[model samples]
Target: MARGRSLSGPLFLLLGLAAGITVGRRWLDVVEVRGGSMAPFLLPGDRLLVEAHSYESRRPRPGELVLAADPRTPGRELIKRVASIDDAASAAELRGDAPDSSTDSREFGAIPLSAIRWRAVFRYWPPQRAGLLGPGH
Candidate 1:
């Protein structure tokens, strides 16, 4: 007969923590604002808690903010508002509040649902700007 040795308590706990962190990263993410494109709303240096799971059930509506992968710059991301959606085409148009200075869907075309990483539900940084983003414009 052979006896099996299971993971020790601390080791198991560490493993669980690692797994949770990985899962949590995929389920939720955090992003920081670095530009003024979304100014007057989201400012430079504002940190936001991104709910990565929010769009798994339904598409974001117009005026709702979302964090999406930048089409022009791979590995980079952008935070923009949902401008329009085409269910038939399975794509969404995104726009920055400042159209004149923004490089958004107008230049990049509609982004696919897969590119939308998260719906920004809360602004958790800067303390002064901490608040829940209310429904649509």
Candidate 2:
């Protein structure tokens, strides 16, 4: 009844998987924590699953962890909390959880909306603390 495998079924499945992965990449980003700015909650070397689509889908709010482009450095990324917001400009005043050790809004000023790239939604590393990331501890 069968001398060889049917490739049509397997080919379609592979194609479907590829398409899904491509589309999924657009909504999520994998980032690694590089500093102690977001300490206690997110330490250096911790990996984050960022929700890129959230910034595109909704307005960012206070106390939320957001991935943004460093104002002083081109192409570098920073993760900080929204301590305050400027509704008039639709921008945010970002700060680190450990303010004393952070170079944030106080150093470079509020981050423009365009500089924001994604919202930190989950921590997928260090099995002990793998789950959804809320506003605070």
Q: Work out the TM-score per prediction.
A: 0.79, 0.81
Position 82, candidate 1: lDDT: 92
Taken over the whole model, the C-alpha lDDT of each candidate is 0.78, 0.78
| Cα RMSD, each candidate | 11.0, 9.7
Candidate closest to the true structure, highest TM-score: 2
lDDT of 1 by residue, 23-125 (tens): 8788766678998888788889998767767688888888899988898898888999998998998889998988887899999999998778688876667
Candidate 2: segments with Cα more than 4 A from true spot:
1-22
Q: 3-121 in candidate 2: lDDT tens per residue?
A: 13465543453454356447787766667899897787789988777777777777788988998899899988889999988989988999999988999999999988877868987
lDDT at 56 for candidate 2? 77
Among residues 3 or more apart in sequence or in different chains, the pairs in candidate 2 whose N, CA or C atoms overlap within 3 Å are none
Report the alpha-carbon TM-score of model 1 versus the true structure.
0.79
